[model samples]
Target: MPPLIDHTTHFIAGRWSAPDTATFPDRNPFTDEVVAQVAAGTRQHAQAAIDAAHAAFPAWAAMPPGQRQRLFLAAADIVERRAEDFVRLLAAETGTASGFARFQIRWSVDLLRQAAGWGYRPAGDVLRSDTPGRFAMAVRKPLGVVAGFAPWNGAFCLAWRTVVLPMAFGNTMVLKPSEEAPLSAGLVLAEVLEEAGFPAGTFNVVTHGPGDAGPIADAFFESPHVRSINFTGSSATGRMLAERAGRALKRIVLELGGYNPLLVLDDADLDLAVNTTAFGAFFHQGQICMNTRKVLVDRSIADAFVEKLAAKTRSLPMGDPAAPGTVIGPLINDRALAQVRQRVDEAVALGARVVTGGRANGRVYEPTILVDVPATAPVSCEETFGPVLIVQPVDNPEQAMSEALATPYGLCAGILTRDAQRGLALAERFDCGMVHINGATMAGEPAMPNGGVKDSGWGRSGHYAIEDFTEVRLTTLTQGALQYPV
Candidate 1:
């Protein structure tokens, strides 16, 4: 067993405040062993974090952009140096398999490096003026005191994503990480920033127990110091937060749930399709928001595709996340396990064919594939955050696209076809925010616009996030005054 981690204090104003008497246990999902004791902060702590960020905003934002860039670069180096420790921490806190943990680390490093370049980009642009001898320009300025909520599924990567870009654009942030992964998703980030010599109160973190987020959220929504908010989590939670943010008249960016789809055309490479589907449906046990949930295959290739995918799913290794060979690990908790079981069992009872797995072995639910699932089944329409895939046959490409657009989610979609032109044409028709040709739905790049539409939520991440975190102000100077009609 690894040594237990103890971080039972809120990080406020660049220092770790005294430990909170009320604490919560963070457990290893596979073994149910307590991995760390995290502080359970109250509304007061949340307010203090916001206040600290507000106080530090002007100086931090006023600093030279090049100096800020260097700090982010140094933080990236620190994270890279502590890679092994972070791998273990993720496994212990969130049951993240070695491959996924490493992927998170790699992307986080990339994100930091990418964010460092933002300082060099033009913050605004010159505008044409119709009046003679007039100069006009539009400039971007950071919003003050951004409030961020990070989810646990992609703990390390999402936590970095939630705050890094905004901070890079001269904004200070107060983060509230998921209780289930406070150390991996919250304090570890604080440690890196501290080691990199970030200014005091430039970033703050407040953690709460599972059912205790209400107070913290209330504080974030009600505080006048909080100018904007960002969240990565379920759609249900995002809706609640959006309502509060709207009432408070604050701007918000949300990356919520997704019932992503993957289309397999008849002319697709069968080998590549099967390989991509298996990875997309089962990676990290399908807990990712981008995980493929529905697969629409041309009727002629449906049987062959299902057979190959089921075999591949069954062959995946599942066990302790600490093992490098394990591909599928335990769900976050009993509730997640129960939810998967209930959805799979309910679908089976409703006459869906279970092509491969439909049972649980302790905390690990086996990778499951269902064919001919009824449209009315909850698993067919709802976002099931587990290792489950629903397959359906479509007669033509039009029907396939129709089925893909039938959902409330518009996060992302994938198309597998031999004809790149046809794939691109179809990609253009997708109402979602992102589409990939001959690729899996689980694809992402740090420089690309990452976000969704409709019920999947609005706003984008990566290079595009700056637009949401900053305000545009137009300025004009005239050489001579002109007569005005009053």
Candidate 2:
């Protein structure tokens, strides 16, 4: 059954308009079906969204911080109230399982709550002065207008992460959501703000295509109103956006692709390690950026670990995401499916062994595992962005760490070890931005910081993501006047 298309108009200035000849159909990847039709916003609409955001920024930035915080809290409430609907719609659009869909909905709510805390907090620091009455302090303030470039994977969550913080900090936004799955969920997220009495233009969703993004980004960069951009997507595209943002000297918070690693030490609990790795690496059909792509095991336990991991992966549920007990689902589309297949085939031809699953049917690629993979194969070096794991054996932790950090990508890394001190030590040595001890690389808590380094991307998310969306301005309030540095 096809999901109903809700909220088809471009949401600008707090109203919806199905502008003439500016609408597009949004399709579901699971069945290659058009589930929703929404406005395919033009460059004109993008300009309008930016203009509206610019017009509203001053008032929003000047509003009482407490009031802004309360508004965001209310938005969080609305999000929670609509959780079930959001999960269902998200599953339909992105082919995410129930558990993963629920996680996305919950994370969005948590991010809103976290962002709310930043709203009223005095974003300033006091400085010690050399002279009496020479009071000096620096305060963090909202960046005027924000352009949020969201991708299709975890679409609502990514959009929520980008916008909630910016909005909470009093910056209005022109959000360009991915055209692949812009329907009920993401649109409804923007609606919650409007419904919660947020002023029109404070938040606007500009519906458009990938091609449309270049123009929108260019305009936002040129506009004096836009202050920053928060983007979550591929490194190639992220680099382009970062370059443009840099040219404008605009701030950017980017969370890009990953070829993250999961290291299983000899002392680790085999059952726990196998279970977590199987689920973590294959979840969402390996579409997640943080999914464990490479598994480095201590040579002593390599064979046993692979046997258990392969069996666990083979048992994972597949097919319809909406169906109960379905742990795996189809890739986003035919392109993604083909990419996964080609990578697996090429890796095998280059001396990698497919211990299990290297097949594709339509958009569904079997949860696959490849062993003895060369360090240079795309499966090992690049972000396959599919349900495939490459396993390699190392003689010791030193070798494991060395091989793990061999790739230029360093988004996230996971270590499973019995020794706490060893885990912490290894965590510090890993080149990635975030490290996980005794768990899969995909593990994330809404309250915890997330992101990566190197080619994996820049910036961080989670509770502190709001800090990236803002700027600091120093202010001095002196009673009866005072002094000079010179």
Top candidate, metric TM-score: 1
- True-vs-predicted CA distance for residue 143, candidate 1, Å: 0.5
**How far out, in Å, is residue 119 in model 2?**
2.1
In model 1, which regions exceed 4 Å deviation? Answer: 1-6
Candidate 1, position 39, lDDT? 86
lDDT per model vs. reference: 0.91, 0.81
Total clashes for model 2: 0
Off by over 4 Å in 2: 1-5, 477-486
Clashes of each: 0, 0
Model 1 lDDT, residue 247, Cα: 93
- Pairs that collide in candidate 1 are none
lDDT string for model 2 (354-443, tens) is 888898767778999999787667777888988999888889999998888888888899999999999999999989888999878887
Alpha carbon RMSD to native, model 1: 1.3
Q: Pick the candidate with the highest lDDT.
A: 1
